[model samples]
Target: MSLPDMRFRAEQHLRRQLDFQHVRTHGRRHDCGAFMLWYARQAAPIAPVAAVPAASTDAVSPDGATPAETAPRSRSHQKKSASGPIPARVGVVASKSAVGNAVQRARAKRRLREAFRQHQLRVPAGYDLLLVARSSLNRLEYREIERRFADACLKIFPAAKA
Candidate 1:
């Protein structure tokens, strides 16, 4: 698949430290044992970043912003995707301390991403969600994690279901 075909759109990622901080400070937090889910509604649309393939760029950083995300690069060669940004901006975190070794952390993150993508539309637009992985993430089954995520979205973002 082409880069744009697999586009996870830069705007849908919580690419700035300040964005993560804002959600943590002002958003509501829900502990699902497997992960901590943080939700905040954006006041208005933040300026959309140029379309870039997420897989080619950065990993989750300590400050939450990767150098790729922070650095301003030329948009001259970039082709804008026909689609606009989705309402939900999501950040997924898996700490070595909380989630264990590299392999385990990766698995947790992978599961979390799959769970979110499967239930993406369940979350309304303009809402930011941060998913921080816990130790339990690896222990639980993928279905269980998915169920928890869906349940959380259903309860918190019921507008989608309505």
Candidate 2:
């Protein structure tokens, strides 16, 4: 049987410097054997847009005014509402002080990313997560690393609410 697409997309990652700083400053942290997990619940999902009728040229405003009479919504507001909820994002930090040379650091990141990608569905939505690698991470096998990550996620996010 063909497995489902599980590729990690850029949108799924915690990319912004501000996001990282926010998590660092305010998120709760959990220490697994090989790494530290930092997480925080994000804001509520955006309100879904109302469906527009294809045949209607003139849309009625919510306040009982014509479309032209109503003030146009800002572009940023439209974009924010269109994009919907931000999914659980993950950021991996493998510093030189913890994970040795560049190659090792990259390897650690790759392994962590893979583990997160495979088990991301189990993790609850709407959390910003940061995983900081430790020196001991290099010694563990990939399976062990994945197991550690899964355990950490379970501890950090106990019940996966629908």
Best by lDDT: 1
Q: RMSD in Å for candidate 1, one decimal?
A: 11.0
Clashes of each: 2, 0
Question: What's the CA error at residue 114 for candidate 2, in Å?
Answer: 0.8
For candidate 2, the 10 contiguous residues with the lowest summed lDDT are 72-81
Clashing pairs in 1: 87-125, 87-126
lDDT of 2 at 97: 91
**On a 0 to 1 TM-score scale, where does candidate 2 land against the true structure?**
0.71
Q: Which candidate is the best by TM-score?
A: 2
lDDT of 2 by residue, 76-152 (tens): 31123246555677999999998999999999998888888988866776788898999988899999989888888
The positional error of residue 143 in candidate 1, measured at the CA in angstroms, is 0.5
Q: Write the per-residue lDDT of candidate 1 for residues 19-75, one digit (tens) a residue.
A: 788799999998887799999985443455665545646465578987576655653
Q: What is the C-alpha lDDT of each candidate?
A: 0.78, 0.77
